[model samples]
Target: LRIRGGAVEAYDGAGGRRHWTHTRAGRRPLAVRPAPGHAFALWSDGLVTDTARTTGRTVHWHRAVPGLSRWLAAGGPGRAAGVLQALDRAARMLAVVTPQRIAAYRTRDGDLRWVLPAEPGCAFDARRTARTGGALLVAQPCGAGASWTAELVAVDDLGRIVPDRTPLRNGPPGDHARARKVVAGDR
Candidate 1:
């Protein structure tokens, strides 16, 4: 799912457009969670909208905290909740966040499994990383100006944060230039 022209649009496996839901009251969609089998969940204006895969229609809506749209629009950090598949377990789970924590839910029945406290005043965005063996990689951007920093955390399939992974740090200047030269030489 993606937001375009102030509407949230869902697409099919073949890249065909399925359905579009207009944002209510001029609020753009904050985040979209595309689940397996073409079904998806959208977050907008403190609400979670669930869509049916086969029918391309909304099934229901759930109330969440307000101000997520504005927060995300300003790149405040965390990602909108959605379904994540665990390849090892052969199951899909829903991942959502509150202002202070992150939680996981069973997709098959919307069952809550776990919740973890997030860093205060930071946004948690999850993405797949090669370093995590398919677990979700969470990044929190913090600080400002010359003191900017980002913290990295990994969450495994069972909703537990993986320990001991080192947080990323900004390298000295010219690191990118050297890395680019090395990459160019390899080719």
Candidate 2:
């Protein structure tokens, strides 16, 4: 995501507590620094048609949004309430799309798993999440045009995509760049 401008905010640990910071005065997703010890996951946000900016001919800018920093706060470093569930199925890994951070976990033993993407912005949150055959099926953003495109992503028991990627367009980015953090869990 082209930050265009930089905006930052401090998040209150309390649920539903709201905070806002000024960016360069525009309607776009501003990159912010997480609490204290957050991590960032770099994955693909999928392709886009450049018909709106730079060239009307349509092309791809950076398929990757700025990596999100999952803060290492008091509760759980890079996690919410120290727990993450993909559709409430005990997520082996949690993906926060709004700010774009990924974290791996193991509950019983406090075993921590971290799957940091080497390639930036290759993953995105889906519109829905479901489980079939022990797989986590998530709708993810795919190609783009004037809208925010998406697709289905299935992570097998091994935590990997099967068909890898499939189209399921949700809508467009409009003027705002996609948020670094997506609402956690299946939509």
Candidate 3:
């Protein structure tokens, strides 16, 4: 499937015959990324479209929505909200991060799963995220001034914080350098 203008088109790979097309009113297409036998599309205004490869049907999830309005209201104007941080196909979760919180949503249906508030004086680095053993690990920089250290947070599949199983600071246990590399966008 491919996104052109405001529509997503599914065409025959062999003969280039158009099979189906879906479009949204008043929205411009931004990107279409491949999922596991599925397609995930994003709009310029933070809207998402989940298109099934087989049926060519689509589900829309506006990232500006649900509880984001509250966050935007509380912060007032000039605060950026509804910014998507990551999409975990394996965990079937979409991580949406704002200045104040990080929220997880079901990728398949756009159901809100959980919301994690940012620690006082610190924010989460969504790019520094990892998935392992049914848990999603996120990194937050601890401390205030010039120097900062990475603090790892482990959230289980059920959206519960796993305190005891949390990995070491600066990265996961046993391989701090590797984790740092990942956080640095080396991999």
Candidate 4:
């Protein structure tokens, strides 16, 4: 609830949950809703979903994707083996900043559609993506405070990278992303 005059008196649930809940400091929220879905949240920090409200389902250990092993091994055999091992999984995207560490999804239907590698200025805290046509926009956050760099990648039919990396600056709605011919498809 807002200040009628000075003091704060929230509505039903909000008033009872003051101790455990907090709001954004300087910014105003446009909307609020409960979290959704049946699959449980896999994060330790807790993730909220709609449809279900407070919590959802737990991501079982078997479903979890393990990190790369032997990725840091020395010699040609190490790196070669590392890449080969990772490619065995059915993935749609193989985003990587380096060969050893990065996160992307592997589709149930083996399709290496896209890869969003971490950019130069990015701190590797958020998702980085390079796409081809269908939902191929990768938004990379700029430094803290304000600004964002996004690239709308274009992929080929074989799901191989076509390079053509595009550079973008801050823009309006829908156009918050931008890209032009840049890098050649390395994959």
Candidate 5:
């Protein structure tokens, strides 16, 4: 799919035109990223998708945490920094990081599954660091002044944060380095 003039256009394998959806006015889409077998287009106010759009799929814009909305309203940097597919593709989950938090939603229906608080003053690095069992490791940079720290978070197939996992500290911010790099082949 390609976005042009605030619209999403889908093309066939032979490059033939398929269909298109014009994004809602005043909703500036910052990026378009691949989902499991489809794709998602991220807008400043919300998301617009050709592969997945249904009734009752609207996100409650008012429900977003105050800090996040404030950051977005302020046109904070790295607003579109992180977007990824959940390691468990069968779950059809999409993870997106705003300035203050990481949110997971059902890609097919746009149901919010979970939202994890992210480190303040940091941008979530979208790279996934392999898989551990049914969980995936996520990292972000938490810097104070000239010093930097890496905070690690883990989420399961259900999009819930896995607690008790120690945060990686004093590491190179946003490096792909991890304790293990086990690929979760074909669940």
Candidate 6:
């Protein structure tokens, strides 16, 4: 099977005969992943497209946060929610990361699970992101001028910011002692 110009085509390998074609609507797909039961998860911008391999049927899943339409319309942090940063299939969550916030959705049906917002004037560093035991760990760089520090923050599967009991960093104790204090205070 191959996708071209928003169309999915399948040709018989033996005789090179055209088997079927399925046309999809919306922007081009950014990434495609195998889902349960011979289905595929295709994401583009903020839309989730699930296509069946056998029949080539399509289902478009729109990911959105409830009661945040006005905020999103006003150009709030949720405005950039479409840009996907990471996907955790085992956790059954589709994570979207921006400098301002992180949102997770159910990969099966594209339901909004949780949204983690950054502190005021602080931003999350997506480059150093890591996941452990279903938790998404992100480095948030926050502080005043000349005294800035990258603090480690962990978002649990339930979207709560919880302290990680296990050591995420391997550096000296002093390196993360102060960072732990900041993260602990949030709890």
RMSD of each: 12.9, 18.5, 9.9, 16.5, 10.0, 10.8
TM-scores of all candidate predictions against the true structure: 0.55, 0.31, 0.53, 0.25, 0.57, 0.50
lDDT of 5 by residue, 1-187 (tens): 6567665555565767564454567766555664445556666655434253222133323222334434455666455555444546454556665545677765555656567776566665554344677777766667656343255667753444444443322122353343332333367
69, model 3: CA deviation in Å?
10
Order the numbered candidates by TM-score, best leading: 5, 1, 3, 6, 2, 4
Best by TM-score: 5
Tens-digit lDDT track of model 6 for 85-128: 43444434566555677777655556565677887767766556
Superposed by TM-score, candidate 6 places the C-alpha of residue 58 at a distance from the truth, in angstroms, of 2.5
Query: lDDT per prediction?
Result: 0.49, 0.31, 0.57, 0.28, 0.53, 0.52
Error of 1 at 154 (Å): 1.4
Off by over 4 Å in 5: 36-38, 47-81, 119-135, 144-150, 160-187
lDDT of 1 by residue, 75-176 (tens): 543454332233224335555654455666544545455666766666555442223564666555444532333355556535544443332211233333
Candidate 3: residue 113 Cα off by (Å):
1.8
Candidate 1: segments with Cα more than 4 A from true spot = 12-27, 58-70, 73-91, 97-99, 120-131, 141-150, 162-187
lDDT, model 6, position 138? 78
Please write out the lDDT profile of model 4 over residues 7-108, one tens digit for every residue.
222333655542222232332222122112211111111111111223212221112223322222232322221121122122222332223223333222
Give candidate 5's TM-score.
Answer: 0.57
Best by lDDT: 3
- Candidate 2 residue lDDT tens string, 15-100: 73434332323333322212112211121121111111221222222223233322222222222221223322433223333324
